[model samples]
Target chain A: MSNIALEVRDLVKSFSLDGATINAVDQVSFQVRSGEFVALVGPSGSGKTTMLSILAALLTPTSGQVLIDGQDLARMNEKQRVKLRREKIGFTFQSNNLIPFLSARENVEFMLRLNGRLDHASRIRSDELLARLGLSDRLHNLPAQMSGGQQQRVAIARALIHNPAVVLADEPTASLDTERANQVVETFANLIHENGRAGIIVTHDLRMCQYVDRVLQMQDGKLVRTYENKKEIRELARGSIH
Target chain B: MKNFFLASYLAIKEVIRNRGRFLLVALVIALITLLVLFIAALGEGLANGNRQYVANLDAQLIVFLEKSDFSISSSRLETNTVKSVRRVDGVADAGAIYTSSTEIVSLPEPLKVSMLGAEPGRPGMPPVIAGREFRGGEAREAVMDRNVALRTDIEIGDVIQIRSTQGTEDEFFDLEVVGLVEGQSYFFQPTIFVPPATWEIIRPQSQSELTSDTPYPNIIAVKLADPLQTETMSARLVDEISNIEVANIETTINNIPGYSAQQGTVQTQGFFTLLIGILVIGGFFQIQILQKVPQIGVLKAIGSSNGVVGLSAVIQIIVVTMIGVGIGGGLTYLFSLGFPPTIPLVFNGSRSLIAVILLLVIGPLGGMVSIIYAVRIEPLKALRLG
Candidate 1:
């Protein structure tokens, strides 16, 4: 309980679409301890994006609370929320959307620069992360110069460069093939387990669900079930790993 | 911060990538700058011409007649009126000047000249190139400008015809062209200078009775004790005279009505033209922001703050603006050389500097506006994109 990295209580989010109120995320609850790798698995429009947005503090939940290390997220203003996202959370997106202007190394180093923590001290860490991502030779290549998997790997490196407490990856494997996807998932799992830094990956691919410690299923913007699986592609809604 | 640098780097990268659009914007800026420069050059030439003319004269002010529009003929200042102005507060000295515009028939081309009759000590009419100055009270002796002397070759003893404005009575007198004065104005006309007594002989007071004009309008010279009081004295004279209109400083410089107003309009139009430049240039950056919205979202999701994003946008704007204005101002200065002498296009660094600063400020302001649109973008939307 004291090691819990994230705790969410009954969260709700609604949007008016064509004058009809649709609940994008409704009464979602979950908890993950430090070092845990959690997977939020669901089909498209299942509120995974909305949940991820709320977790990142980019969007405020309509109801309930989000507690990261027991610090309630509901009380923070926009400034504090931005600060919280800067200092504690890290994100890796689906498309490996790297800034085209910078080289591979600068792209990864960006996470440190934003928090006003970029300096000589961050250089070694950025280099190390790039190397660990198997991009040491291509560290100077821009996003336009690299392949899909390589860019995604660099993005992951960017997310982890700041040593954030929690890493939020939204469909990190969507743009990659199976081999690349597996490799990315394994890399993420290895980093989370090694650093004890909690990570939550949102994916619809059931094949990759076995890599995470727990998988939460969402329907109609609510959590419907949880599965714990160590085996890849176990029966959905039937497997659980402790 | 890491986020700001990252954001700015991305913004700049987007702009540099679209080299064609950026170049187009710069070219348009240069064109608009050229128009303003053209007008400025014309203004500059006019000012220079006036200054050269005034410096040659050593006269502080030009006194022209103030008259009612009711009469068909142009009214002239009386001989007594010249003395009365000489008695006015700021007057240090005075001279009687007689002027009439007439065409001389002897040359290959009929030259129109302003025939001046004075006592020969006026500030501007000096140094007779071929003859002496208008000597004291000589009714028959006259001096011509250099170009006039060259055209007719009328020496010290030749006679010339003074065409009367009344259309029938032309005075053909042995007007001895005693001297020739050097000036560009001489090239256009045969300017003859005679004493007031000579003007009295040539066009007598008998002509004044036929028309509303005074026969001998005094050719006045107003020597101000203090040059600074010139404005005050001019204003007082204008107010005292029910018909005179005082031309302002800028008007005197450009010799145009409301010169300051015209300058102000040109400056303002230039400002807005540069504003259009900003929009076109800044529009590139604004697009830079929107295109990077997804990237910004990713950064936000990755723990990058909003301030970091905003800072990056502003930095990108600063970079582009400085470069754009540098190129723009440089081109403005470079091409202004070919402008005609009739224009006044002064390259004022301070004014251009202010324009550049305003242009530079527009860049950041442009970025900031885009930043508002950027940081508010949902990090989650980045997740949703294909």
Candidate 2:
């Protein structure tokens, strides 16, 4: 079996703005192994969001391949890509985009429903997952009735419920308080590690890097450095990195 | 099928959760349904009003004066013409029919009725619903349409006083109501069937032209030996007889004064109402889809196929529209019950059913644009992530 859960092979993404070609992601390559929780950290306009979008199969790269479990995204048609996204990849946007009309539990179960795996067992699993996320009492409440932190937790549960091979989160704690942010990041990390799924999160706050197994730092559309040492990761989490 | 159920469940759940928002759209659809159904009913009513009398005729062909434009009122056939028509080959029976407008002297106000004179038990006479057909040699007996009988409160064995004219002055004739027929109206007025002798006395005759003291009937209604041979037999009659015209029942009914014009006007109005219904439904759903773009994007981002999202939207529209149409149909039934029979509003089951089917189909047809717009909503742009 392949140990790598996700592989990005020299991915490049370009856009045209005002008749000028700008590369959003330029020849960046990385691999996330199974059961590893990594963080992609960068400043605004560092192309982190664009990179995450490509990994989630929401956007196509200009060149290069995104492989999930050794199957290349570039070689697949749109229908195949959609099926892969539904069955193997999970994502939570920065907005915690839960359907407003659905209850907290229904929002999380929606992923399984999309894959046609929702059943009584999955429904019970949904409740248990919400309970794990400290939202047992709010499962029946709509997104509008839940707080920002609570909605984010529901989104995390939704992202992991379908047992996707790769879980991609972009700024999962952007709207939470510091304590709640730390708690959410810690729980997100625990879920990823426990589920043995390759996970990646993009965040500007280096302090959130403490819960991650590795941190890939980026600048100017390139992966500049990585913090894999525990001491170095601790310093990075403390915002003491030079 | 499971995917469809999921889509349907989501659609129903959202509609239930947001009942207030959806109810507003449902109310608009209900109003449109009311207008459409009413227009359909009105069109049927106006058409029935024009054709009810002629439509019920048992004759296969109607003979008229050659230059009378095939109008029953303008056709003045002599007794010799009726005898000549009956003697033609393939002509099974020819009955003389006379029609005129007269007033029934009733309480409160006089009711206008179409006076029709036909031989007893002939094809020209309407079938009786109650009492009995005119007995042989019963000249003073009359058979009233249900509308006239019900409105005038005259029953069997009751004497009906009708104001008639002979030549110069108006006179009253007392005719006993021996029978009642259902839904017989002529020229937009309730009809009363009388025998040929009473018709002659009530019919106006000129004093200077009183020859043999006998009155000639207006139109001759011919029943062919084989109904399918109407065209050939009708041509034969017109060829054999002079100064006469022959037409089938439907063609003669179409030639009724103002009938085609009235039907065309009502039909045009009904079509316009249907068009407006399409526009209203399409516009409502388009706005609904526009407001739900981000939600749709979230669904797509979660890996829902285009079919799922589109099916959900279509299910929502059909559910809401069916409810609205049901309410509208119920309301129409309730409101129509209060209308008097004279209101000229006829609601037939088959026509209403057809109209309802058309209305139901338009719900999906009109929402197709919204479905396309929804399915085309780009996840990246809608989520504002790229």
Candidate 3:
């Protein structure tokens, strides 16, 4: 397979409110190659979540196309799109949306179950994934029984356990402390590189950008700047850019 | 099949985690099932009480007076009509019987009884279970129903005094019980079978009709040569005889006074009980779905199809309902054991099965709204991220 895991083409999304059209995502494009972790930084109402939703194939764009693993999202029927979402895409919301009734290991294995590939080997992988995220002792605890940091790590494990082509996380560290957030992001990056899967994280904290391969900044629903150089990315992570 | 198993697994897990809440709802369903089953039992008991005697009549056709409007109590045919009915084609045997309700003097407080007089070994007489049948030329002799013997101290060879309200003054007759027949109650009273001639003398008669001396029967029981030809034989009898109406055994039983209305009331109550069950189950599941909105959203976000979610809900309903129904059936059986035989409660296997099946079906029917609600829960809004 080619290394280019995701390709976007002038993606635009608009919402009509009270007889006015607002461009939530303007004509913008980016590509994510395999084994690369990218961070999307934006202010409130900058359309980061909307762009992430489109990339995950949870929402259809008004124009342009999102191609994941060489398959166009818009061209597939609802059934095919649902199958693609289950098989090729993994995502986590800001709240660490874990199934409250399922234990930590069950929650991670749930992704494999959705893809109809859950087996003895996959069960072992789920346990290994959680253990790598520093949740080895809390595998059998429910989401309600775990701390916020622990739950977020379990969510990360769930996202990667199914081995999807693209993994998306929206503010996954919002509920964790500064130190734990750093550990989670660093572990997330290592997992992405090890598995050779493309990963994208949307967050407001530039300090988290140090773990990512590149940083894409958005302003007014447009990709205004990019920090690809190691020097620039490190400066942004140090809070040195006012 | 995999989806079904997964759905069931999820449903069972939730129920086990929240067992107290589910148990409360299940208890309510059990009580409703108990009440409905009791109502059905009462309906069967009351029907059996009213129609038991006529239903067991060996004759296929019951000939009534044309002017009585199909009412067995008011139909009166003279003795000559019996001879004419026996001569009709396709008639195997015809029997004359007279019936009256009167008080027994042997009991302290006016024990009412339905007195039926028929020729021994005829189609109208009930089979004797305990003692001997009537011999030839037996007079002032009677056979008491088995329930009467069991309920009272009366036995074979006991002389019973009956007080008749016929004529200007009351007449007393000493009749000896010679036999006992089982399940022969009529009109909610234990019946006593006597000779036709003796019954005519003791039957209530107005002063004007007392001196006529014409033997009259309330109805005629006609046995057809081929019982399957009930319709054609009945039509032929009505054509050959004048001033007579004919009905089959089922029609005759249905025409009993208050029988139809009693059964109708119980059936209506049973139907309303089922409706209430549906409403209760639907309301509970709707509340459950509303409370589990976020959980449902998470499942959907992880790629659970609507079919999976809906099937899980249905499985939950079915499991809960079966548990409740099983408990109710057991409780009903236990409760029925303590009731005395005099009470009119009866539990039949087939009718109870029908009621249980109806309850089981209603559980899913009631949960349909909740299933739709679960499947329609949008993940974006439920997670509050939209």
Candidate 4:
């Protein structure tokens, strides 16, 4: 409990469509400790994206408390929340939104640059991270020049470069093939554990769950099940559990 | 300040990466700048050409006939009027000036010229740049303006024939150019100065005025003891001297025929050009921001503030506008070098400076709407994540 990096208490997000209220996220609560990698597995309309957006500080929940490193997000203003997001939280979208004008290394260094931490050591670290992700030769290439899997790996490097307290990714491997997806997820898990950071990845593919320490399954905007045992999680990844 | 630097960095990098696209936009802006500058120069040049002679007069005040309404051509003052003006208090010196239009048949093209009559070494005589001034009563000696010298081959010691209507016949007089004065254009034509006696004999006359010998001058130019007291002296001259209206050089210049209308038209063209520049720049930037909505959304989502995004757009606009204006200024200078003096395209320094400042300011002003649009973009809506 002392090492917990993220805490969500009774988080509920509602939306109005055609004069009817719908709950995108309803009374969801979870915790992830430092050095832990968690996978959020759900169906297409299972509120996974809404939860990720709230964690990224991009959307506000109607009623809830989201605390990162023990600082409640609801207590901060918009400016302060933006600062907190840049300094303490890192996220990658489903499209791996790399700036097209920036090269692969520049894309990764942008995260550090946003936090004003882009120094010589961070530059070296970015290069090392790219090399670890097997993109050593593509460092100077623009996003248009790289394959989808390579771009996804670059996105992962960008997410970790700033050393944020919490890293959230939304379908980061959605564009890659199965083998490329597996390699990217394994390297992501290794980097998160090595850096002692809390990480959450939202994905519909169950096979990617093998690299995560635990799996939380969501349905109809509710947390339905939790698979914490390593063997059971592996069995779920092997497609034995519905 | 830190945010500004970061925004500038991003803007500069994007500009460098997309140099070709930005260069094209800059070229468009440069062309628009050139058009505006050229129109402004034309307006100044035309106005200058019309009033150059009166604008450079040595006298501080011009006395015209009481009902002439400040027009030098319409005013008629007898020799006694000039003498009375000389006797007025604070008057240093006063001279009578006779003006009329004639054609020079010495040139193959028959160039029209404004013939001015002035006493040598008097207030009405312009300073000579080369050679000697015409004698006080010399009938055939004249000082030609430099524009006449530029348009024709008649130099000092060359004889030019002036053709004027006298009574029912056209008479020609042979005059030798003794001196040259620069930039004394009157009514958009090159001017020549002759003595009063010769002007009276050969100046244009209607059929009915063939026998009139009054030798009335068009106006009287008055020099004051203290140039700073021009307004008081002008009032005193009008009050003390009957049958006369007093005016300063500026009022005399403004009363030139078609001067105000020409200036106003050219100014309108330049104004429209600037307005078009704003619209074109605003439209281009608005489209640019719209196309990059997703990229801006991503930046916002990753913790970039609206200030940073809007500032980057502003910096980009200013940089592009500066480059465009610089290129246009260079091109204008180069084009001016190739223009002949007859083109009436003078670039006055202060006026050109003001025009350049306005051109630079329009860049940021034109980009204001686009900056607001970029700042107002919602991150979730832009990324389609909501």
In terms of lDDT, the best-performing candidate is: 4
* Ranked candidates, highest lDDT first: 4, 2, 3, 1
Model 1, B233-292: lDDT tens per residue? 888767665443333233333443244456567666766766676566557667867777
Model 3 B-chain TM: 0.91
Question: What docking grade does candidate 3 earn?
Answer: acceptable
Chain B TM-score, model 1, reads 0.55
Pairs of colliding residues, candidate 4: none
What does candidate 3's lDDT look like per residue over B181-200, in tens digits? 98777887888888888787
lDDT digits (tens) for residues A124-147 of candidate 3: 889988988989999989888998
Q: Where does candidate 4 stray beyond 4 Å?
A: B337-340
Sliding window of 10 residues with minimal summed lDDT for model 3 chain A: A78-87
Query: What are the models' TM-scores?
Result: 0.74, 0.96, 0.90, 0.95
Better of 1 and 4 by DockQ: 4
lDDT of all predictions: 0.67, 0.87, 0.85, 0.89
**Native interface contacts kept by each candidate, as a fraction:** 0.62, 0.66, 0.25, 0.48
The top-ranked prediction according to DockQ is 2
lDDT of 4 by residue, B1-386 (tens): 87898899889888888888888888888998888888888887888789988888889999999999998889988789988998998999998999999999988899999999988887889999999999866469899998898789788999999999997799999999999998888998889999998888889898777777557899988999998898999999989989999899988888888887787898888888999999998888888889889889888888889889999999999999999999998899899899987888888745677778889988888889999999999888887788
Number of clashes in every candidate structure? 28, 0, 0, 0
Query: What digit string (tens of lDDT, one per residue) describes model 2 on residues A120-216?
Result: 9999999999999999999899999988889889999999999999999989888889999999999999999998999999999999999999999
Best model number under TM-score: 2
